[model samples]
Target: MRERFDVVPLAALFLGAASFLMPFAALKENRVVDGLLLNGFQLAGPLYGTVAVLTAFGVLTGVFLMKNGSRRRLLYAAAGVVCFWLTAALLVRAGMMLTGGAAPRVSPAIGFWGLPAASYVLIDHSKKGRWRMWILLVVMLLPAALLLAGGRGEAISVFREWSARKGRFFDELIVHIRLFGMAVISAAVLGIPLGILASRDKRIGEPVTAFVDAVQTIPSMALFGLLMAPLAALSRTFPLLRAMGIRGIGAAPALIALTLYALLPIVRNTVAGLASVPLSAIDAGLGLGMSQRQLFYRVEWPMALPHVLTGLRTASVQAVGNTAVAALIGAGGLGIMIFQGLGQAAPDLILLGVIPLILIAVAVDRSWGFMIRRWVSPGLDMKGLSA
Candidate 1:
């Protein structure tokens, strides 16, 4: 039987071409049209037309080389094109930044795969056992470099100017950090206990599971509103609680809302992980003269660690993204930029916020995923379980 060709690369190529052309057709002013086209070329120039054409040719050649076998060579060719484009884009961006050139017009197509390809290539090229450590070091150092190189100062100044009516950038950062921290901690505390209780008692499991499931049915914004009045009451009753007050608004309400949103996945995952432990393992532990505590701590918990970690990873990513909605309240976050941009009709500023939030979530998910795969699930290859 003849092998079928992979269509993904072809699709990506067509999509990229269309992305370049769409903006060209939309603009009316001659100078703006010319400028957009020029920008598109500069943006696409990193992966020159020649490179794309050659990559397509290489894919065709590989098909013949393999005699139409099931093996995948197109992935490599496509990856190569992506890497070349990304490297070029990064260098172009660096040059533009240094020389005070016109800002690179954003292309969603180019933006989507560029950095990811570059990062993947860098990691793939690094020596074994040290790749992750090096990646972390780069991540930590890049912001510092950008800061000292002027991006940080410029960002701070812009944010300060925009939020002058609100507060300092540091203040906004603190509020977001606190809200995120509270949501995470609260979810863990609530979820873990419920998970343990559910695992211990069959009667407790059904309703708790149902409740968490129902929580998911509630829209997040609606939940925020629902919690506002109760939280406000709690805040009013105790003067000491005033500092932690929800006020039916701001970070406190946002935190409560996010915590509620985060609870279900962690709780459900934890319950599933704990309950999935083999009965034979429990029997063996008991037969080995282990106490209940020992059986739980030494056997069951270790088996469940991967699952628990999986839940944490999921909850963390979800919290990071969902926290953006906290901007609807007074809790300031990167989402503030997104909302402000929407209000001002500036898509670039919206992307500025959204892009970083996505980067943060990806970074957290990948880092935690690596740790879970390498350490928590070492014996059984439970990386799939994390997924």
Candidate 2:
């Protein structure tokens, strides 16, 4: 019989193995200039032979086993993960060795970045549920843990950058978090009521959603500019507001703009989720003689809750990304670092800001997923929420 194999994991493994031939990193004398590429052999140093052998063996063996329909898929995934971790470790070691006493910078290149993504595919394809989550977590953390323990490599470079501006980094990070947090909370508070009104009245819903959709079209920078004058006048007119740290140029306009940006998704999703509730459920609640308010609170809202949470999740991720743009107006978040990096042409500095933003977005999405799974009523089928 002809053998069959899983395509995705196999592709991921092949891609990862191919990355070994690409440049793993670059050594730079300064942030702005082009640096020299360090291939797998250079990156792995004394471990070059070991890394090369494993990359070839793992890819070949995994593909063969998968083709033969063996039950050892997880074993292949585990091996891929080990290869990935060792590759990262060696790259870090090389970076440290190069930058040990010199001021030269060691920044990760495409191969270094691509390897982890490919490894994630391997891990994800092989496992299910908490096992996948746990293994992924371990695979991700082990490289960092080893880097920290060794005190070397690109990890050291990022840490050095962090140390140089540690105070500013944390402060700006806090501001960035607060800005998006306030925006999302305000959007939810204002959005849910508007959503409820819209769900109950077509007249109200049409105008409200249209207004939100219109607001969403305005460029963030332009929105900030639009709010600047009005807020400035307000702050000047009301000394109390100025004293309360409500500034037109800084966080105030940024917050307002982001809040408006967050509204459309939340309100639309809320309306959609509520409207999607079963008519049979509504009639049954009425047949039981519940008041309109009682029926909504006890029935519709419970059923609509998951969809609403999904909306919140969408808004939150959007807000986190938009917060980066808010830094242009001096709102002071990771965007500040990002822009500074751009100005200086420092990729590592940019990563310092961007990596955290990506992580935050992922965390928000995962947390919401977990909550929906745990808190939403099992009787309600929410598979249609995105509809």
Candidate 3:
């Protein structure tokens, strides 16, 4: 019997190979003037041999996927991708080491960046279960851990930026976290009640959704600009609020904008989850002398929780991405590094911000997904939502 194989992962694997052969990073001086573009072949570090080995394994895994149809094969492919990812990081460190510690700026080029997408495609194609959560976490963290253990070259090069500002990097990182957390909390607080109200009353539902939907349509910068007038005026009118850090161009407006953007998903998911609850269950609860509150808390909330959680996951991811925009308004997140990089024409500085943002978003999205799979509903098909 001939086995049917998935073509996408196979294609991605070859693409990853093509990327590997290409220039992985550019060696620069002082993060401004580009020095030399270097491919993986140029820097033969201690792990250079391992990089070649993993690259071969990735190629073979793709071939295996093409010839065989099994979840096990896909898992192996994912493992290969993970190994390849670590290889790229080590390759960067190797390149830096080859530069002989001139404090060269190592800017990751196309190949270094593109590997993650290929890895993601491979992993997403694989059939996952509750047991795979640990594997997934390990896979996610392994690259960073290995890079750390691989050599000091990687750490020193990356942390050079951190060293420039002393403790400021940590301070900005905390600000980013606070911005994300506050927006999500506020959106949830408002969205859940609005969702419940909407579900309870069609009359109220249409307008509330329309308003949030409208809010969603406004561009981030425009929304930030729009908030400035009122917020600034309010700050001027109330010194107490101004003293409390409720400024127009800082965290306050940024938080408000992100919260508004977040409301739609949370509200939509809450309504969707609640609406998905079975009428029979509700009637049974009613028959059991359950009050309206009891009926919702007992029957509706539980069933709807999984969906609501899914929405929160979506909102949370969106919030992370959007918080970067908040940096434009002086809210001060990782986006500060990004914009400064752009202004200075420094790609390495840009990556310093972007890499962390991507990691944070992915971490939140995956953790929420894992929780949903484990605690919400093991049987729920997450593919549609994820896709």
lDDT of 3: 0.76
Clash pairs detected, candidate 3: none
Cα distance off (Å), candidate 3, residue 136: 6.8
Give the lDDT of residue 370 in candidate 2.
81
lDDT of 2 at 113: 64
Model 1 misplacement above 4 A: 1-12, 15-48, 59-174, 381-384
Give one digit per residue, the lDDT tens place, for model 1 in 211-243.
888988998888888878887788888777787
Checking candidate 2 for backbone clashes, the offending pairs are: none
Angstrom error at residue 210, model 3 = 1.1
lDDT of each: 0.63, 0.79, 0.76
Is 1 or 2 the stronger prediction by TM-score?
2
lDDT of 3 at 337: 83
Candidate No. with top TM-score: 2
- For candidate 1, the per-residue lDDT at 108 reads 33
How does model 1 score by TM-score?
0.73
For model 2 the local lDDT of residue 313 reads 88
TM-score of each: 0.73, 0.90, 0.85
